[model samples]
Target chain A: MNHLLNIVRKELKELMTIGSFVSVLIMMFVFMGAGSMMGDQGESITSPSDIGFINGDGGLWADRTEEFLISIYVDTYGISEEEARGFVKVMDIPLDDGAAIVEGMRSLGLDAAIAVGPGYSSNLDNGIRAVISEYYIFTNPGLLGSAGSSITSLMIGEISDRISQALVSEIADPDLTPFLLSPIKGTDAHTYIDGELHSGVRPLDISMGVMNQTLMVPVVIMMVIMMIGSIVISSMGNEKENKTLETLLTMPVGRTVIVTGKILSAAIMGLVYGIMYMVGMMFYSKGMTDIGGLGGSSPADLGLALGPVDWLIVGTMVFLAIFCALGLCMILGAFAKNYKAAQTMTVPISVLAIIPMLLNMFASWGSLPTAIQIPLFIIPFTHPMMVMQNLMFGNTAVVLAGMAYLALFAMLTIFITVKVYKSDILLTGIGQTKLAKAFAGKRIR
Target chain B: MDALTVEDVHKVYGDREAVKGIDFSVRTGEIFGLIGPNGAGKTSTLRMMSTLLRITSGRITVCGHDVATESDEVRKIISYLPEDAGAYKDLTGRAYLKFMAGFFADGAEAEKMVAYGMEMADLGDRIDSKVDTYSKGMMRRLLIARAIMPAPKVAIMDEVTSGLDVINAFEIRKIIRKISEQGVTVIISSHNMFEVDMLCDRVAMINDGRTVLCGTPGELKERFNASNLEEVFVKAVKG
Candidate 1:
């Protein structure tokens, strides 16, 4: 036990000494902090006069519309003081008598423009519909969409206010006395459901949900790859480098004990960094939303369907996936002549592990081929994300099966690593094995 | 009783035969020297005896346990310092000693053994410092310290003095002599004929992995009509 513990401490100390470990953590923090700050900018409201309108109508309706728009913008979008300054430049465009500097403002990516046509008041008096061209522009097409929707919402509110005022004026008598005088209930009260109620949940929110889920897939893929690849390869390489492997082999301890000790240490580190990276990713996802690159739903909405057992299964699969990676690396390490060579050889294996995760991410579970699925199920990592996805959609049986398969896979990897280590530890140099030689060894000439 | 026995041991690496059926025994309380040229399989022969490598087709017994079948039992009875002995670089010398000590803790005699080993190593203040900070001589001593700290029944040192200065080399020889006198078998391998002549009770000269000459330093010098063991080696290899 002491020997194994000593080995673990030695491994950790070496990892901590490397510059790359610290650098990755530092970068995650800085990027996440910047992202969160930008995400909180809220929405901006601009009026036509803010864009510098000047026309024969003398800005009367433009001024009224600006005032109304400002009120609605304040009540709805919740733009911050700093955000308002950046957005205030768009309000400088003029909109009076159906004329606005639309071309110049559009080129600058200004948010709002109001063009009141020559017969704007005349058309209202004659009760004829006319187009009052109000255009909002933004550098980001998505932000432009949000600005357009906010403008439409402002228009609805203004139209509703006008209708309420007109109906009040039509009945000059106080409205409260009529209800008692008629003694009959107002012709039948009707309840209407507005389409805006369904549409009002911004497309940004839905798209954000898609963006967050997709983002998790790749980051998790890279992390799972590195966790399995780097940890296992480096550790096994270190053993070969120190030549303690020869010492370990001759000890009374079984070859499996040595392999298990290494795998157990690697798994613990993998899980530790795995949890750290998951937390880092959570911040990263939050940061994306904060920076406005993603503006959809929260992460919870996607993961909310997965129950505790499903999460446990996913966690276990991740652990096993790490174990399998460690096992694969140990086999590679045994064949490698030295540390640098082992690291070089393990790269393709890591890429192989990552590719499956990526395919699992983009393709539906059932759509994957049987050959792929059989191998995929046997990989500890392949199942977790897929199972997590299935769990979110309420598939319990898949999660259970995934957990079982991953456990079996972990055991198999352990067995293979031990066999490889026992056979090839004393062998020197990196030698390529033919497809037939992969599961067995032949004497080199 | 002999502390170590090698009976017709052979080690073959592919088509190349390293140790070709060499046989010898080192009784308790004697320092045995093995001397040979490069590629003469001296290290391979030592490795097989130490249980670090397998005997290709012969038997090796350490303290009455078969090296092939009871390797761990054989290992506990012997301390082996390989040709390229390495110390864990990250550990302070003292920490390394304690760590090596911890492996034998259940024996009830570990603390006394470790203390005796430390004193025998004669590292002075440097043992508390990290091994990376140690000089080559200091590192060698620490390795020797760890190997001996367990107080095994026999000790195998292979070219361990390759990098040491003359004075430190003599100091190491003196330590080996003291341990040998105390009933522990010591097998020392070196290419330096004079060092072997000065230190060993009985010397074995290997040529092409076969024992060409085996006798005490005095007996070999008398038989070869040579002034020193170096001439004895040259004469034996030439023949």
Candidate 2:
């Protein structure tokens, strides 16, 4: 019993390292930051009131439709009718002028615009279905970007019910009134994404389509980065543990070659893993799209598919991201005393990868505040995760900028890794400082 | 010609000075031994010569190449076998030898080195097995073969026969003597005074990061009126 206790105590001592504690703390902070970002996004999505109203009908029912929408907005938000009017902008424009509608929405900061047709009231009174066209402005492809349009659709449904209730009370024909209760039907929605209008496609449909394809990209990228990072760091740790690094370092090879060789090999392995994961994810995404009925209108039909050149660009970004991860792992691995400590070294990379992945999943890059976006853009792994969305939206400049930044980041990290390889820290294991020495002693103990 | 030179070498790690102004030189084909007790800075001195650690102050040169500024050139002509060295466990013994040999030579020349290493290790069929399966004696033999197979002008070995049985130690000493006979200068550090007295042509006895005595084994014993190098070390360090 005493021997068993002693063995358990020794195992605990070996497992508890400063590196492990620090890694756990970093992971905690990353999760906390993600939660805060998610909370902000929730607030942004739920309280949307940026709606534009265009009454082309100029009839009693059209006016009534506008009035009912404002009334419902006021009730839902618990605001006065005047304040609700201030939130909903009214425009007098021709229904055929799609360009004017887009310009009006952008200039008015409207999330969506509802345009009533010229014969809406007359058609409804004559027992014919009335048409209301919805124009959605998509500033980003994020899941939250379509929140305003979705809420406006619900408001339109409420207005149709309210108009039906008013008609039923006025008319004595109960059978006709029952059929006319939901007389107002929406026409095919038009979405303006990044200044180009896509006719007949709702923002929600496009958002769902984009989500179906790309939701797994960030996850796969995160996994691949962590996988390759662990491999590189563990390689260093194993070399140190086996005492083979001293022999390799003293060999007639240049430090740069050693650094590059390790990074390149790990990157190749990461690419292989990434390809395997992406193939599996592709089939899974296809199956999901088919089951969810999103396959009827592929993203290609909506002009959201990547061309050959775009895929090449994405390939470059992924390669650069892998290089950056490998370089970073090499630097962290230099401080590792052995394989156990190297496992902890992968935490920072995981945190970096996860931050971008979560942000890409929940929020669009354009929807995020500058403070959040800047850091997200700076993380090397963020580029590959975001490149597909940017290219689909024809934001070529942003994609190019990301690739440039990743290249520069990869170069800088490789330089630093080489410096570490040449330094005594590789062999001495970061014992240059008194605090580090204390930690090293604790780790050994 | 001198195969290696250490001029007033000092190594500082944080606040501690592991090797303080220790100086020595080894001639061509000489079996030079750094004889010291544990923590006497023998391994530190060997590491500095191997270019694995930087000299905090002073200089070391191998075959007219400075270890600090011309480390690549110095590395080309010297081989370092750390006291607790190991090969990649996942690789077979022959593969490990081939990988190390590729750094010095290529293709046919590399194959030649592998054959010679296999001959030196004398493990026969076991050389095809993974390095992780080898016993301690076999591992040591394989490492010794790797270090000597490169035909380095100067070989720096730290505690070459440490943790080995008498038979393994005897076999390694004979191998070291044979390498020295082939005109490769050898600098070996050891805590075993008996081993140093028998294997080394000349010895530097270091204590507490400084050399206490430096002479041929016979001269050191005669000067101290001792029967063996262990007594010589005791008398020198105590006095």
Candidate 3:
């Protein structure tokens, strides 16, 4: 036990002192903290909001739409009449001058740019509707951006209907009114997900949710597992190759002591990495979208009101995953002849880690067919990858079940790792079988 | 009193026999040598005596402690230096010695042992430099110092000068003689006949894992009617 403690101390010192470890650690906290702080902004469309108007059609309808945008901004932020004119800037963007519009908005630091499509005038007359392209400087983001774009489109449509109504009313013939266009409406309505009927929930909301769940969890899982695997393998393999392990074994210490010490060291390092990863990702989440929390809006506007329970879910799942990864690293390290061969093992292990993450991104257990969902749940890595999604969807039962399985899996993996150290192949640097020549080989050390 | 005992120690690897029924004993304070060619299993025999390799069907003891059942106790009294053993690369030479010394003693005793190890290294101020910065000879000297510093009842050194320049090898040989003179029993294995001739009080010629002949270097040379220990080794292995 004394030997084990010494080994752990030695391992941690090397890991922490390495230049790359310290630098990367600092980068993660800095970037992530900035992102999180920025993301938690309020969502109310307030005054001093930068709005861009790119007029493509150069027609009466385009001019009218631009006027409506300025009025809405004035009303939304409750600006006074004197300052309302300064709240919006309308630039004449020619049909072929789309590139200039992008550059023009970038310079103005605009939040949302209104790009009037070329077909606006013709489509309004012929089809009673036209498409207006919306570009947010941060690009089209979550709830706030979608809400802005939809509001502009609706205002334009209302103006066009009024114009159509007035044109027919001015006609001398009574039959002219009968020939006027009436807006087409669908009779049937359907929704994919049930429960709380929230308003203004756009398809882009689903897209934002998918992006949030996929990017960090899958990629980081692969990175952390492979990194810990490499460190453990290199440490053990180098000891064997250099013949330091032989010297250590002959010391008056039990083999289990040494092996346990190594596992503890790597596990702690993996946990530290896992924590930094989550923090950085939370901050990165802000930079991706001028969403509810970051954009000075209520986080609930984006359905992203994550509480302490959610954090606990992420923490527990990540901890279990690291524990399991550390065990696998120890076992593979012992099995290897030296560092190089052990490095080769990392490739397959990485692929295994990534498979579940990929699967979770496309197939949430709630949506997947029952046949496929059952098997995916059985795969241990699926739990870590799916924990966030499950919590988001309020599938508390699945998260609890996954936690139970992962705990058992981690225990079993560590048990096997400990058993491997019972007999070691020390000096020869050749692992004949079962970590050493346990049977059909040398009974000697 | 004997410092080490090996009774019919056999080591089997898979379908092959690595060490077969080797018996030997070393008196306290004696510098003993196992001299033979490659694949002679001298290393295997020494390994079993050091409690490094488990015996197949025989008994071994170090300082009256059974190497098999009481391997930890056996380890307390002896230090085994494997061929081409290496220290932690990033640690300073002095730090490496202290790390090893920490396993056996503590407080002033450990500090005293560390001081002795550094003194024996003869590395001057370079002992404070990382082992990675040390040359091959310097590393060997540092490792040798770690092994004998604790002043164990018996020190098992395998090829203490296997790959060294002449001056470095001579210096290490001188250290071994000094260790013997201090009444520390030393078990050394080497193919270098001259080293055995110069340093060993008694020598054993092993071949195919068994000791074929054993005596003092001069006695073996005279008995085989040979000019030196090398000729005696050659004759015994061939027989």
> Quick one: ranking by DockQ, best first?
2, 3, 1
True C-alpha contacts between chains kept, each model in order: 0.08, 0.85, 0.53
DockQ of each: 0.09, 0.81, 0.30
> How closely does chain A match the true chain A in each prediction, as TM-score?
0.49, 0.92, 0.53
- Best by the lDDT measure: 2
Which lDDT tens digits does candidate 3 get at residues A129-201? 4555554432323333334444444544554455556445554455444334432121111111223323333
lDDT of 1 by residue, B83-200 (tens): 6556667888887777677666645576776677678777888778887898877877877777777777888888978979998888888788887777788998999988999999
lDDT of 2 by residue, A1-445 (tens): 6999999998888787777777788889888998998777777767746689999999999999889988998888888899888878898778888889888888888868888988988987887778788898776647765655677778878888888788777776766864567777875588886557888777777777787877777878899999999988998999999889999999999999989988988888999999999999999988988786564345777777888998899889889999989889999999988998798788899999998998888777767789988888888898999888888887788899999999999999999999988988899887676877677556634
* Tens digits of lDDT, candidate 2, B61-122: 99989999999899999999999789999999999999999999999999999999999898
Leading candidate by DockQ: 2
Better of 2 and 3 by TM-score: 2
Name the candidate that leads on TM-score: 2
| Candidate 1 displacement at residue A245 in angstroms | 4.1
For candidate 2, please provide the TM-score of chain A on its own: 0.92
TM per candidate comes to 0.65, 0.95, 0.68
Query: Which of 2 and 3 is ahead in DockQ?
Result: 2
The per-model lDDT (C-alpha) reads 0.61, 0.87, 0.70
Error of 3 at B236 (Å): 1.5
Worst 10 residues of 3 chain A by lDDT: A183-192
Clashes of each: 19, 0, 15
Candidate 1 residue-wise lDDT, A1-445, digit = tens: 6999999887776555333343455556544633442242222224322331222233443344444444544444476544433443433444431123545554555434444445544433333332344343322222223344345434534533543354345444564333222221111111101111121233334334544654464457458667567656765566567654554454344567677887787778777777777888888877777876455654354233445865666666677667767777777667766576566556556555555455543343453447656766655566665765555444567677887876777678778877675442344333333432442233221
Model 2 CA deviation exceeding 4 Å by range: A1-16, A172-174, A177-181, A194-196, A293-297, A438-445
Q: Model 3: per-residue lDDT, tens digit, B98-188?
A: 9999888999999999999999999999999999999989999998899899988899999989999999999999999999899889999
